[model samples]
Target: MAIHPTAVVDPAAAIDASASIGPYAVVSGPAVIGADCILMPAAIVMGHTTLEAGCRVHSHAVVGDMPQDLKYHGEVSYCRIGEGSVVREGATVHRGTLAGTSTIVGKRCLLMTNSHVGHNCELSDDVILVSGSLLGGHVYVGQRAIVSGNAAVHQHVRIGELSLVGIQARITQDVPPFCITDQEGNVVAENRIGMKRAGFSLAERSELRAAFGAIYRDGIGRNAAVQYLRGAMTTDAGRRLLAFYAHDSARGSGMRLYNEANAA
Candidate 1:
């Protein structure tokens, strides 16, 4: 372990031999620093936190801090940064609010500068929280989703896979898969560019477009549109969209679908 003289690490903390702790950093209260992890200057990893292999905690970023919830009564919660993830400068990731629970950041994710992940948020692999974005507690960000700069996602909201949330958007409802939201947080269109870059086939993209048309353009109500697509969708991507809608429906939060009437 190449720990700087100015760094403060608790004797009970587990620091891997290949890890590096930079100047003025603090690793306290049994936090586990995995192999090849880097804690940059002034970074803080507090109690019950675990930085998996190859993770980077940038300067002034804090992980595993206690939940900011009133219900948290000194419970032993956890914050876990997955392998190869990067927590950028001044970002804060809080631990879970309930005892024995964890706030999980998945592999290869990026928490951009000044972003905040509240207690119990679960970020899936390849998720990106752009600079200054804020995710409320219990938010679920799907794989490959991008929450744009300064966007604020409400508590318990779900951002779907391959979706792009516009900059500074105020998102209060679940965003569906393969959708791109406007600055007003309305689902404006399918994420054609994102799907293309993700290597989705032309046929799959066409199917998704048709699916979106059914929901947003066809004027058939959301329920009728979903029922139509349930039996008509052919491609895997289309099925995934349907599955997302089904799951959201099961949650009973009643996500508002953006249609022509709402767009006006």
Candidate 2:
């Protein structure tokens, strides 16, 4: 381990042989640093945290720190950062507040500058929280989801896989997979760009497009529409979309579709 002279690492903390601690970094007791981890200047990793292998924490970032919840009374919570993730400057990842629970950031994820991940949040693999994005406690973000700059997601909200949240959006609802939303949290369109980037086949894309139209334009109830799509569109991708539609997402209720509706 290459710990800077100015860095203060508690003797009880576990630092891997290949880890590097930069100047002014603070690694307190009960913290575990895995191999190839980098803690940059002024970074703080405390509170029963584990930085998995190959993770990089940049300047002034704080991970596994105390949660901001009022109910917290010094429970034995945990924060686990997955392998190869990078936390950028000024980001804060708070640990769980409930006993035996944990805050999790999955492998290869990117937390951009000034982002805040609240206590007990779960971020899946390859997720991206862009600069100034804030996620409230107990939020779950699925794999490959991207929350754009300055977006704020409310507590207990679920953002599904391959979703793209627009810049400055104020999200108070669950966002289904492969969908795009605007600043007002309206489901404006399909996340076509993100789907393409994830290498979805044209057939999958076509089926999803038809499903979107069937639900929003055809004015059918959500379950019936999902059943129809499950029967009519027989692809794996279609099935995944059906599963998302069928899932009980309470916040999705009362959410308006992007299309203009006429009073009948």
In order, what lDDT does every prediction score? Answer: 0.89, 0.88
Question: What is the Å distance of residue 33 in model 2 from its true position?
Answer: 0.7
Q: Write the per-residue lDDT of candidate 1 for residues 1-264, one digit (tens) a residue.
A: 799999999999999999999999999898999999999999999989999999999999999999989999999999999999999999999999998999999999999999999999999999999999999999999989999999998888988899999899988888888888877787878888899999999999988887776776655655776787799888888888877776743223233445533221
lDDT of 2 by residue, 151-262 (tens): 9999989898988888999999888778888899877777777788889999988887777666766667776876787787777878887787777775662335745231
Predict model 1's lDDT versus the native: 0.89
How many pairs of residues collide in model 1? Answer: 0
Candidate 1 residue pairs in backbone clash? none
Candidate no. 2 TM-score:
0.93
User: Which residue runs of candidate 2 sit more than 4 Å off their true CA positions?
Assistant: 253-255, 259-264
